[model samples]
Target: MTERISDFAAIAGRYALRQPLRIELEETGMNNTTRMIYAGEERYVLRVYDNHRDREIAGTEHAILSELQRADLSFRVPAPVSNRDGATITEAPDGKLAAVFGYIAGQRPSPESGAHVEGLGRAAGELTLALAALNPDARLAPAYKPYYDFENTHAAMNEASVKTLCESSPKLAEQAAKAASLLETRRRLTALTERFKELPQQWIHGDIVFANALADGDAIAGLLDFEFCAVDARAMEPAVVLAEFPGEDDALAMNRMRRFCRGYGSKAGLGADEIRLLPDLMQLRLMDVWLHFAGRLAEGLDPERVWLRETERVSFACGWIDRHRRQLDVLFAAMAERQAAI
Candidate 1:
């Protein structure tokens, strides 16, 4: 292996120039392991990518970071550490790619922080707007990629190879089959894609959940994680945010939706069709999660894991499907009506 935690000390010892005072690992991130090394009064964030991530992806992330830094947006992005040759990337002992960022002093926000939510929305909106402004014709290396057509709900569920992975486990067998069925239901809603005719395409932060953002009270302190960044429908960005937020009522959700839309519209306006499709996009988000849960269950993940580790998860997903089924129909009808109106 090229990048293991044990070698981190030696790597830092070579780079810090000055003696490091303390180094500690942060455990929150799932895809990459992060460590904070304090060299005297200054702090730096060391990020180690997973083995599955290739060098090209690392270079792509560097390009995205460089773009965001130059965009001069109203948020913090981790700065890459330049080597003795002023290169941003350095290979670790475990054969993994490593980069460093100046640590932003802030804490990850909780679901309850309204100010944080607003700030996050604003930051994301700004980033989306900036990315949208960039010409699609810009020259990029082979590693730089735009996010596109990643809505894998149907394909993942229907894959025969994926099914085979679950067949040995009875619990997963049922869940995988259910997941495939749900995906079919979602497939029936393909007409919604036409709504995107009026919706603009832009670069989007694919994962805008709370965990990936940092806040100081209601202010967005930093936006992190560009691994899933890609080009996609502009509305898809807000849809992703709304999908992750926790709210029990339509009123609260609508409020959040309005905040997000208003922020984005203040810059780039949304068409009537795009507005109508927002609710359906939110539902699509929910369906995505359920299908993912089913896929996990099929993959022999604990029948009951975390909050969803129970037989009831299946029933809950089904209940959500039944309740939202009519809403989806209405939403699709609204989309058609908007198309007619436009």
Candidate 2:
């Protein structure tokens, strides 16, 4: 607690906020320490990253936000604030890097709302185009491996490690066994890899679940968190978002996904190949999540249930997609046709 208090004091000094500013921890994100800061009439967010320690990566995140602010899209995104030295990333006393973003006052949109889901899609589509334009920067750096780079990405997550971690509990073991079976065949599918090779590559936010976006009524107030920004297949952008659509069965899931795609297609183009590969790409996204959480649990950073929840979600999503492959094809084809018509 003393260390935390000292860090807050240093942050206030460096940011030139009023002395002894009121800072309270925000109990939301899983990977980072987020704090809401109150300075007289102003408010801001202090994000202390837990996933990566590289300042260059953080700088690239800020640069992306800086460029996005210039893009002037229809909605808002987190804006990085510069400290007294005009540096967006502040080195904390304990060596972790931190940055403050202007606070956005809005709530996370409901996934159940068609308008909210559609709006999220439009924002993603707009960002896809904008980020594509903003890429190949000399300062651009990777925050996390792209989802499709399964080998280099999941190499550390070996079966032995996963098995040992699973032994800790029967519930987790079942989730692990389910994940292992589901991922084995899908990850080895040559067509998934080969098809996406022809698609365009560009910078994407890489993580865009609904929690990352703040909504004002039915509209997107701002997009938050770019910690996973990476240069990847352009189509991978929407697939990541689509994987976040939740439902008990294929119809309900597809409804939300189709709405998101309609909104996205209306704003951006999805080629025939891109459209066809979306289902496979979305499965890959789920795979990444399960593997990511598994790795986190193995390293003792996360508990069993945290990983279990995501594994179950991934398990259900993968099966849901497979059972409805024909619908998946029709859905994306429709999305492509709609985009072309527009």
C-alpha local distance difference test of each model:
0.61, 0.82
Best by lDDT: 2
Runs in model 1 with CA error above 4 Å? 1-3, 14-17, 136-148, 151-156, 159-181, 189-198, 262-268, 284-342
Among these predicted structures, which one has the highest TM-score?
Answer: 2
Query: Which parts of model 2 are misplaced by more than 4 Å?
Result: 18-20, 163-169, 189-191
Task: Report the Cα lDDT for residue 76, model 2.
Answer: 86
lDDT of 1 by residue, 1-342 (tens): 334556787556546444545778665476777888888889988877863457666766677777778886777877777766576777777677777777887888765666666677677778777777654433323332322222443456554644564465565566665545544546544455555544676667767777888887677888888776666677777667765543456556445545554444434444566566665565555655554555665566635342134223433444453565455345434434543444
Supply the TM-score for candidate 1: 0.76
lDDT of 2 by residue, 7-104 (tens): 96677568977544788876559778888888888888988887778998898889999888898698888899999999999988888889998898
